[model samples]
Target: MSGTFSALNAATTALWAQRRALDVAGQNIANVNTEGYSRQRADMQAIGGSAVPAFYSTSDGIGGGVSVEQVTRIRDAFLEGRGHTEHANYARLSTEAGALEQVETAFREPGDQGIQSLLADVWDGWEAVTNGPDTDATRAQVLQQMEALVGGLHFASASLKAQWNQTRENLTVLVDDVNAAAASIADLNQAIQRGNQTSLPVNSLVDQRDLLVMKLADQAGASVRHGKDGMVDVIVGGVTLVGGTSATKLAVAGSLDLAGTGTSPVRVVTAVGGHTVRPDGTAAGQLAAMNGIFPSYQSDLDALAKDFADAVNGVHTTGAYDKLGNPGIDVFESADGSPINASNIRVAFDDPALIAASGLPGAANTDSSKADEIAQLRSKAGGPDATYRRLVVQLGVEAAVANRGVQIQQVITTQIDASRESVAGVNLDEEMTNMLSYQHAYAAAGRLVSTIDEMLDVLINRTGRVGL
Candidate 1:
């Protein structure tokens, strides 16, 4: 009688275990399209008979039943860690490539309306003036061309400055995002810890936290360290952004504008101690563009502006004279009389009569030597034209390199993500197969229950009625 009851109990346990496994498969199928969800598995353990012997107790050495041991997510810790690192690298490269492309658009190199074309027009204007030194119309054309060149320089400088300021603003926003993610991670950490202590399911909570951790990795190059009780520490540049249930806030400090960057460079730092964080992801790329790339281009433009002004002014004020044969003054000056740069380079006087087109004093209307000399500057080995060409070439090469880096990093990131997905991502076909297996096992367990019940009925009712 005891053995027959034990058989029934074993069948009941099988039914329950199979039902739990089916439920897990169903959960996986339901979340097939859900982001950051890991596939779950229900582990089963066989229940054994008691080891101690007792009088009148039969021993068959057979298992009593099957039971669910635990439910766990199928995840690879090493793959997840690698995924975060590759994501950071991809974000940085993409950001830098985007910034470089923007800069290239601003320059408009090799195009009709670009600075190169404007510079060519200026040299042509000088040649026109050399052909008719006494002609006010030709001299006025020279002034217009110079104005165009100066305007081009100003536009280029302004674009760089604007991009720099925008990138700075973006950094502040990125820092805010990082802080928000850290706070959310800390909150989730506390919840997971509490759930773990009470032996409650915390898989969903862990998934949410992992997504936020990846966000931090992309935004700030944060890394994670697992801790006890289902908690994780988020670190950036060796500083913990989130430790257990506590989060550290971050701040952006220093330059607000590109003009001020020289004196006060931009930095990402901890909100409390002002410790700098040199991040490795998107923030790092923006910092590189703002602090190094944009500024270098601006400086190159400034150098070109100053050099062009100095060369033209030296020729114009020394040996040349205006139409009235008076000693020529400076032809280009800043509005504030400061040194000319890309931002403030302008024609000092608008009147064509003030232009010194003559090579000799008192022969202003006749001599074209000065105008010819200025026109010849276009072919000078180390002239403004050469400098501007060099800047354009450098920009093109850098932009190309940045774009290439983005492509390669993108390939790597995609491959890592694919590997991670294979490990943790749900598969509908596999889940359907598992569902069928669980269904058949459940049916078998039910059949066993029915058979055991029939046997018990025969022993209790039919056996006593035999031969009555």
Candidate 2:
């Protein structure tokens, strides 16, 4: 009777264990398509021998049936860490490539309507004046072309400023995103810690936390450190952004400027520690576009404008006389006393008669020497045209480099992501196979329980009745 009872007890335990395993399999199947879900496995172990003396035990002493030890999530911490690092790198490069492409669009190069073409027209106007220096139509054309040149400078300068402002705005928005993600991660950390205390399965919470951390990395190139009790710490630029259940927010400080100097260029800094965070991910890309790349182009444009105006005005003021028989005054002046940069340059002469096309006061109206001299300035080495061409070529090279960087990082990032998915991502086919396996085990265990019940009935009722 004792042996039969022990057998029935073992069979019952097997049934419950198998049922739990089936439940685990069903859970896995349900969340198979969920993002960031790590597959879970039920750990089963055979129960050990009983405390009964060997002499008193049955000859076929297999002890007890199976018992579930623990159900654990399947994940490799090393692989996940590697994936996060690669994700950050890929995001930074991608952001930089996108911003550089926008800067390229602002230039409007290789087209007729660009500043380069307008400069060429300015030179052509000078050449026309050389053919008919005294003609009112010729002088009017020169004046009109000069005004158009100035307008082009203003347009290009304004466009660059707009791009800078837009980049700063994007940085502010990204900073907000970074802060939100940090706070969410901190909240998840607290929840996960609570789950750990209660011995509850917190794999879902961990998945959500990881997803948020990845997003934060994209925004700010954050570093993650896993701790005991399922907590994770996030850091950016050597400053801790999230620790345990506490999160530090990021703030944008300063203004956007073209000089690349002053605290005017916006910066990302930790709110608690007041540590200045260097540009890392998308924020780094935006800052580079606003303070570094765009400003450089702006500076070049200003320099070109100043040099072109100086060159033309130098020749006009010193070498020619106006139709009023007065020596030429400066044909271009700074709107303010500051250097004649692109934004503030204007034509100094308002009267068409004041344009000095004749080399001498008493010279014939057709004395085109001064006009010829001005036209020849276009072909000078390192002049405005050459300088402008060099600037364009530099921009093209920078854009190409940025694009190539994005492509290379993308391939590397893809490979790392695939590796992570293999280890952590759920596969429906594998889950289905596991489901079938668990079902068969469950069925076998149920049969054992039924067999044990039948045998117990025989021992209890049939054995005593056979002799009666």
Candidate 3:
């Protein structure tokens, strides 16, 4: 009687166990396409195996129904580390590409009518002045050409300054986002570590933390480590930021003035709990761009300006017309709106008629000397044009190299993620197969119960009636 009862209990347990398996399979299938969700599975074991009575006192015994041991997610830590590493590399290259793009915009070499063309036209104007010397209208034409040339220089210089300024502004904005990401990651690390210490599964928190880490790496490079207690620690550029359940706060100071010298130089400060931590190369990506590229371009512009003015003023000061145009006089102003050289200019005409009639030599000197000066000005413009053109070519090369780096990292990361899915991600086709198997087993358990009931009915009624 006890044996018969055990069979009924075992079959019942089998039905429940198979249902649990089916439920787990259904969950996996439903979440297959879900982002950041790892595949879940049920671990099974035989129930009452140790307590099952041995037949004939031998070791062999009737197996009891199954019991679920535990549920778990399939995950690999090494792969996650690799993914984050590649993400940071991609980010660095992306930043460089953007800065290069801005440089390309400033110069726009090889365009329909870029600085190179403008410089050529200036040369042609100078040649005309040189051939026909004493025509006032011709010299006036030369002055107009000089004015046009100056206009072009001012435009290009202002445009480059604006681009550089915008880069700094953008860096200030992205630093906020980077700090946010780091904070979330640190908080999640604390929650996960707590859960692990208490022997509770922190699956969801772990997932969230992993996602945040990925985002952080995309903003900057980080070195991630896992402590023995299942907590995460992150370091960047030799500065330790997050350690287990504790986090170091990050602050970025954005203070690069438009002139390229910092009214205040931008800096990154790190603090753990209340203690200050050392700051290092933590400023990556566009932040690095603002700190690095934009300033470089600004310096280049200043150099170009100084060179252009020096070359033009050098030739202009060497000669004079009927009215005086002496050396070491004001020729160009700095970008800050300051005059180049003040207080050295004076009219050299002795005759009141010449002084009154000519007004100024460089004002529109029709003398043959003015034509020679115009020719010299043409040379000055050409130097800067050549220099800027060289810079354009270098920028192009940088862009191509940086772009290639981004593409390579992207491809590698995508392939690695796919491989991870193959091992840990859920598949609906496999789940459906599991569903069918569990359903069939459940039906078999129900049939066993029905068979036992029918046997009981025959024994109680039909056998007894034959005796009567």
Give the root-mean-square deviation of each candidate in angstroms.
1.4, 2.4, 5.7
How much does candidate 1 score in TM-score?
A: 0.97
Q: Flag regions of model 2 displaced more than 4 Å.
A: 51-61, 259-265
Per-residue lDDT over 151-205 for candidate 1, one digit per residue giving the tens place of the 0 to 100 score: 8888888888888888988999999999989999999999999999999999989
lDDT of 3 by residue, 1-468 (tens): 556666787888888888888888887888777787787777778865455446664322566667777667778778777766776766677777777777667655667445566556656665665666444454455455545555655666666667757765665555567667777887887777778788787776877776777766666566688886667788765666667766666665546564534555555555333332223222465555566666666566556556655665555444434333323233444534553221111122223212111213554344455445545554454575566666567667877887887788779878877877776788878888888998998999999989877877787768889966
Clashes of 1: 0
Candidate 3 global CA lDDT score: 0.63
Question: Candidate 3: lDDT of 70?
Answer: 68
Kindly report which residue stretches of model 1 are placed more than 4 angstroms away from their true locations once superposed.
54-59
Ranking by TM-score: 1, 2, 3
Q: What is the lDDT, from 0 to 100, of the residue 114 in candidate 2?
A: 79
Q: Clashing residue pairs in candidate 3, if any? A: none
For candidate 1, the per-residue lDDT at 369 reads 84
Query: What value does the lDDT take at residue 312 in candidate 1?
Result: 88
Top model number, TM-score: 1
Write down the TM-score of every candidate.
Answer: 0.97, 0.93, 0.78
Candidate 1: clashing pairs of residues: none
Selected candidate, larger TM-score, 2 vs 3: 2
Worst 10 residues of 1 by lDDT: 357-366
